[model samples]
Target: MKSPRVLLCVRQNTLRWDGEPSSLCCSSCCVLRCFDDRAAAARVNQHAHGRGTRTSLVRHGDPRVRLIAAHRSPLTALFSARGLQQITRQQQSPATQRRMRQQVSSEPQGVAEDILHLSAWLARQPHLPPVDDLLLDRFLYNCKYSLSRCKSVLDMYYTVRTAVPEFFKHRDATEDSIRRSCEVTLAAALPRLTPAGHRVFVHRLLDADSRRFDLLAHSRRVFMLVDVLLHTEPVLGAVVVLDLHASTWAHVLRAPPPLLRRLAVCFQDSCPIAIKEIHFVNAPGFIRKFLDIIRPLLKKKLNERVHVHTGGLETVGKSLPLHMLPKEYGGEEKSLKELSDAWQLALERRRDWFKAEELKRVDESLRPGAAPERAQLFGVEGSFQRLAVD
Candidate 1:
């Protein structure tokens, strides 16, 4: 006795519905069609036996016939007509192509290619730590994509991290003291951007108590914020708004000159982001004395960008958009207290990630390049000029 035959439809790009061959035009197209009826099987066999049509006959006991009715994979459908048309328009538009090319060219030359080349270059040199694509990209960006400049900055960045143990070492955000300092410092990156596309970062001394203000902890918090921005925000530069309104003389006195100098050098030389401007708002009279102490340490260009405004919020408004500032600065935005509370919660959420970063550091002995001479790189020790106390 012969086994019963099953009729199956195998038309290309055609659908099947209700045991009938159907075109894709139908809104309810079935992906697969199979028939076990003897009459339907006999009809399909007669027409498709020698016509080379997609119809196929299978024995009733064949396991393969049972699998024929399964739905077709959605991945087989590449794109819709509308999607293809949109892609065609984008490719045809000269203005769109030109704008895209310009944006790509603005980045370091061969950004993707350089990542591979730099990785290989670092591997050949002894004593260098393994280079990751993300870190290399940051170095390239900070150096304006110049390969040589990128290499130089990379060296300096790790060197500074190793040299300044006070600022970078043992910086676990989970510790009680460090967490308390982060809350008191109230350093945060604002959601708003400057008119020129620079991200706005505001730092204020929320706690006037000198005991709570640890310069090292404050530096760690600032670096943590910078790390967050580097990965998340896409901006050309940064505008730092330093609100010294609540800062007291005790806080200033606790910030030693040497520590301040190290912080300045790290930002000026090692950091991979451009500091567009540093707005010192609500500054005190004695602030100038402190500024005078560090003025010589700063590069001439950076010093020019530093604006000291003592005329209250009105003076700061002249340089920045008042509408973007917090309510304390006469802006319509959220109050400083509200922003600070929200930021504190954000930091708490990332505590574990920050802790992991604290354990990772560069081994100076492994550097194939010349080790950074701390005295020559930072400056002569005890050479800092004393500031006038009166």
Candidate 2:
């Protein structure tokens, strides 16, 4: 017995899993170049085996290799749902995953190559608008630099802005409603990143009067901050710290299904932001009711990421980056108001960018086929729909 074979998640669409072409790997990696070509498969088998033969098995255990019970052999089994995705992260442990995200790629060559490839692809698409290299890099980073996924998302990214005008339009920071929403609700991007390179976003009501709440406007303001982040921040992902301590039943009632649908579309679908986790701190008595309305709107995977806590921030501190949080929530940073004001100033400074971006949207008429229909995208009940933004 020489040695145990190993399972490799081959990179790109040009070759089968773990072959010579594109030897680099992915967690959600690999696809067969041609399932019908026996010659090609045999060549891959020969290339991997020392004696130029088709091997029946790879190693039984690799933390990177996540397996399922399949009728097919191991070679073909890698083609299962989990193995075929473009984004990796098969069966990695929590600590391992955290370390992976925390480790920023020091090598700029790979990123530079990815940007060039992505930029070329972007140029070929007639319907898509011109995207800056920085924005393209952001998309590439979020997709784990998967060119295929990045291209697919870039299409939807512009399409969503055109489709969901309610959330995307009128994003001017100085406007009275937008400013008023900022005053009543603190939807500020925190100054610090979690140990895993995820930016912390705080959402809460500064005003107890539920009557003052404008869910859409409040949400628009929140989105404005995120727009600033997508272009400026280079974090691996985001961890949302939603403090509902000051909320009431009236606030809960303000979240109607339609508004929730559009809002969900904006957060979950449009932009290329990876939400690592969502922690609801100081959850209220009616948190269940609120979840009941919103949970169904979210994707199954996203629904699993939602966590609710009735206790104080201390409970959340166990998981979230409490040390980086503002003093109001138990941390070393400045108070929440000061942070909110700073973000407000930041948004105001970019006032012209928001104005200019309003002009950019998919000219559906120029699209190759029929424009994406509202009914087809989201049901009649929803003004916006969730795309594969994550």
Candidate 3:
């Protein structure tokens, strides 16, 4: 590689061209040499003046110029290294410029390694919330010392702190409050969390919060967001690290027909539009029955021109009203079974077994995907058997 350029100045009369001091060129003051041969004198002059090239060191009235002394030959030299230093001192602030030069020289060499070490440090921190008030304390300390690291750590602190509640699902909280928590925590913890530790700690904290809200209810919009998150989870673990439960998707799909249909309509206009496919995967068995019950109503709305398309029929699980089952049967105790059973027995005398397909969507594929899956039924035969045992 080419060396970096630096201007050099030789002091006057330093004609040590052959590594020896000559009478024509002394340690100080101008000197000259004369040759008996004119051609030799010209060659000597050219060599002394560096082949007629105007070196940057050349300046008007510089001591290196040959004085009109009868020394028989022209001599030349420029300022020395110490002289160059003196000149630089005149042009720069001693303390400030030196410091700036030092910084410029060191930054380029340190930058890449700094980034690597910083990232590694952030990765090692435990991902737990400050059980006390330590987060803001550490951040303030970092801001005072490691300013750049502080900014990065603060940004992460805010993002994870804010996203925590949203992903975990709890009672309603404002985005502003979440944002504030991040700011406060970062102010305390920036000094404490190394970059690697910061990243890992944030993740662990989020994981803990995620576990706390193991059972989360999604709003219609958030239900749609779940699909988007799931799609991008593989390549980058950040999206997937929150440990999303399969049941969360199931809950979204099992929303009532009206809610699920509304979400589907909203999803149609969202970016990528592919999130709609996630709804099918999240569908639950109860939602299937719910759709069966609402399909005729949706068809009637379509026939009357009150709605454009009968959309909810595709989500059969939404129709199941499984929430009506008591807590003993894995439901929210919504009592839909009691009401439906009462209605069924009320029309018992005029029972119709005709709507087999309509009443139960027992497709062959649904019978058992891998093993023999049993469908728990509350039909008359099952009820009669229970009554006899009682």
Candidate 4:
């Protein structure tokens, strides 16, 4: 049996060489022919660099090199350690450049420019809501930064807002009745974004009193807050964490299927923001039954994203980061009380804007296409069965 032959490369006096027989004179680097003789290897090293090359570490100012066993007849020069380092440096530049380009492309200035262009386009259209930069940007964002989709969503948003007067009409966030309903903390959008850049919204029934639950007022507040978010921030998507702990049968009975249907249509169809996930934590068995009633009405994609976490917060934590959640949910963030108070304060500040929004209705007669029929517009029908309470 023949011993494996080792090819050697040496860098002496700042000149590098590899063990290739074809080229004796080192132009760039040379590879020494594979030899099994230890004495021959030592002799070759002494002649090449006045020292043995067996040690992995070379002195400072010495060329970085390595030796590899070449069993095949043809000696191939394996890249030296320095050569590998150079190749790595070369490879990293493109990735760094790509990352820089991504950073520049994601700047808000570009988004602002797009919104300006959209605002100009909206200025020419009739019977539309006032096309301010903020509103236009929200439309642009909701449509996933597409101009055409933004226009469509803007049209549909107003059309639906016009049609659903019960929810949109008289939307005074400062009113005692509206404030009281919102105070229940059925849901509240967090002040921070998730690691994946999604806007986190937590929903849980704080009050068991069915009479004070006012589903319409809660829906209005939710939409109002959503509108505020759209106008205030450049949100990419939403993550809803629904905690159904402490919810009673009374709360289940108050779940109006028709209102749920309308809300589903509004978010799934009319609204521009993409609901990335709807996670139900501490979900009761009855919640699943309630979901079955509304599941048919929800978009298939959305229904698929709905996760029921009955096991507890650990189950919810698998999808949602613990840092993004409130302290009550075994997280590091502020308590739900603090979050809800901040949100309520934000809603209070936007009271006048909500009133203005409530009055800004789309005139169907002035619309370019055929007016949408009331029945098709609202999605309200007498066919929805009342939710049965056990």
Per-model RMSD to reference = 17.5, 14.7, 34.3, 21.6
lDDT by residue for model 1 (222-279), tens: 7766765554323346778888877888888898777778888788776777787988
lDDT of 4 by residue, 1-390 (tens): 322222333333222343234433332233322223444444345434544444333332232322222111011112112122111111113343354234323333356467667768767667777765445645665556777777767777777788777777776767777778756755667654554556778777777676677778878878877876665544567888777776766876786777777777678766777888988878887887878787887767998998888865546654466765678777776677776666666677766778777767787777666676665644556442221111
Residue 262 displacement in candidate 4 (angstroms) = 1.2
Q: Find the candidate with the highest TM-score and give its number.
A: 2
User: Which numbered prediction scores highest in lDDT against the true structure?
Assistant: 2
lDDT, candidate 2, equals 0.64
Q: What is the C-alpha lDDT of each candidate?
A: 0.58, 0.64, 0.25, 0.59
Residue pairs with backbone overlap in model 1:
127-366, 127-367
Ranking by lDDT: 2, 4, 1, 3
lDDT of 3 by residue, 1-390 (tens): 311111111244233222122322332222222113444334334545764433333233333332121111111112111122111111123443343234223231132244344445434432322211122222322232243544344433322223233332332222344333222211010011111111000101112132322222333113322222222111001110111112233333444444433332222211121211111222334445544543443323232321111222122133223342233224453232332232223222222321221222212232113311121111122221100100
TM-score for candidate 2: 0.71
Ten residues in sequence with the least summed lDDT for candidate 4: 71-80
lDDT of 1: 0.58
Task: Report residue 345 deviation for candidate 3 (angstroms).
Answer: 51
Model 4 lDDT at residue 38: 47
With candidate 1 superimposed using the best TM-score fit, by how many Å does residue 285's alpha carbon deviate from the native? 1.0
lDDT, candidate 3, at 92: 21
